[model samples]
Target: MNPITLEGPRLTFRELREDDVDALFEIYGSEVATEHLSFDPRPLDSVASVIASGIADTQVDPRTVYALAVTLKEDPGLIGYARLALEAHRAGQIGFALNPSVWGQGYGTETVRLLLQLGFDQLGLHRIWGARSPKNAASARAMSGNGMVEEARIRDHVFTHGAWRDSITHVILEDEWRQPER
Candidate 1:
């Protein structure tokens, strides 16, 4: 897990680099893209620090966070951010955000699958779950399409944009996951 990399048909999840600031800012700093995420649009200057932290997370003894840069196979540029944070009992929570330019395509689903692969396939995790804002229908569909069932609603789960928002969680157990057709 020192240097994470996961590839799919159209996308690749690789370790974040310091140079990814501008690309990541395109997604993290977009109001439309982060509308339902846990935080408001981030400042450009802050994105560098985020990348730095992700790079640092990789060097930890027992890595619990995989904050990856989602790049297309054809273009080796960061277009999205994908995260899988490990928890107790062999569980992990996934989260992702893509550049608004790629919203209509199916990359979101692929990103989720790649993260699942990293957790369940590579890390031997027992369960993987993701939480999305109640209003993010696209995220709901993406997670469900990957066999992650809508499990619960956490009240006041996050306080973002100056308000308490609830989150809908979707989960899939190791036994329930079927590897994507190779």
Candidate 2:
């Protein structure tokens, strides 16, 4: 399988590595970073396991999961985690989280754009979608900014943070994606 590596104007998406545990921990282990994610902040050991699993997933034939590291163009340190899981009928589900320190920057939108590019341009997928917590306006904006339309609200979608929570799904078709110039 080809290793996934994508470059945008401000960021790069690369295959996750075992050594990325500590860097990824900066996002996965932070309450603020995992606030809108389905799960709570992960422990350091959990981060290691997550990275390990991601590395193993890449080696699977006909790979269906892309769990990548988001890094700046000039720096090769992991600043965020991005995932795209392929499903049947030419569709994929995407999710992402960034370090809290980089929250306000345009990285989230760029990450979404890169994921769309990967699904449509690279993977030959027809539809790509992502779900975000209803209250996560930042995630909503990021997906929308990348041409993903808000499609549905699934009630009781996930039981997180001690209660059932709804999720807002945003989707884009391969034809509908407006690819950015390289």
Candidate 3:
């Protein structure tokens, strides 16, 4: 798949680049930003690795990960990041994060919607799902608002933050995703 650029009402999603290191480091390393993450990333190499992975993704033919920088359309500055990890159950698994300061303002929801748009509409995928910490109601809401339905709650499925944490899996199939509500 070719590198993509998606536009939302309030943001732009594009391929990650090497120059995004500084902003990515700040967001990924922040305490507030890492609060919901499984682990706080150490800035020295993680950011570079993400960019490198994205670059590598662009070269492959069958497409793997769609790692994008979520930026303000007006400013073109990175505010967060999102990815579609393809090849999961013959579909895609969506994941995203944002600066804590920008939390609860609907950007997360829009970002997820963009991922769905790319996966189902653009990429011709059959199914896509999102897995999130059960405690994060906002994330659940985002998934639901974008036409995903709760499929399961796996108890103690992932070990995060020094303990096993439950996760909620939400999914939307291509046929259902075409509904006007999306």
Candidate 4:
């Protein structure tokens, strides 16, 4: 598959590259970045290794995961990443992260919108879902802002920061997405 480049008002989404390791490290290393994520902050070496592994995995199985580098249109610097992992029966899971410095700037919403369009239109995915810690109000809001509806609340779904946390699961179906705006 060709590398996909999605442009929004302030940000762009493209394929991740080896050169993105440093920027990705910076984003993933931030405490805010790990706030709702499953992982914790770690050394740059470990972060680089993870990025390398993801790149290698994509090379091996293009349909397994489509990881995109989020960048600003003006500066064109790597801010973070958005990914969609294919699951069974034409369904998929969507996820994203951004540098805290760019938080509240609507980049997350734009990235997710583009990703959903690609998943439904290009990838022919029937259903796309996302989940986040219930405590992560920002992420929950971002998901809602991008047309994802809360499907369920998985109680005590994950353990993080030394405690079990509830997870808010959200999903957007292709037919729902095709509806015209009110």
Between candidates 3 and 4, name the one with more favorable lDDT.
3
Clashes of each: 0, 0, 0, 0
User: What's each prediction's TM-score?
Assistant: 0.96, 0.96, 0.92, 0.92
Clashing residue pairs for model 4: none
lDDT by residue for model 2 (1-182), tens: 47889999999999998899999998888888888889888999999999999999898888999999999999999998999999999999999999888878899999999998899888999999999999999999999998899999999999887889999999998778745532
Model 4: residues with Cα > 4 Å off, grouped in runs: none
For model 4 the local lDDT of residue 75 reads 67
Q: Across residues 1-182, which tens digit of lDDT does each residue of candidate 4 receive?
A: 66678787778888778888889888888787888886677679887886787677666645578878889987667897888889999999998999888888888888888889879988999999999987788888888987899999988887876778888998999888888880
Predicted structure 3, TM vs. truth: 0.92
Worst 10 residues of 3 by lDDT: 35-44
In terms of TM-score, how similar is model 1 to the real structure?
0.96
Per-residue accuracy of model 1 over 1-182 as CA lDDT, tens digit each: 57887899999988999999999999989899989999999999888889999999998889998999999998879999999999999999999999999887999999999999999889999999999999999999999999999999999999998899999999999988964542
Stretches of candidate 2 off by over 4 Å are 178-182
Candidate number with greatest lDDT: 1
RMSD of each: 1.6, 1.7, 1.6, 1.6
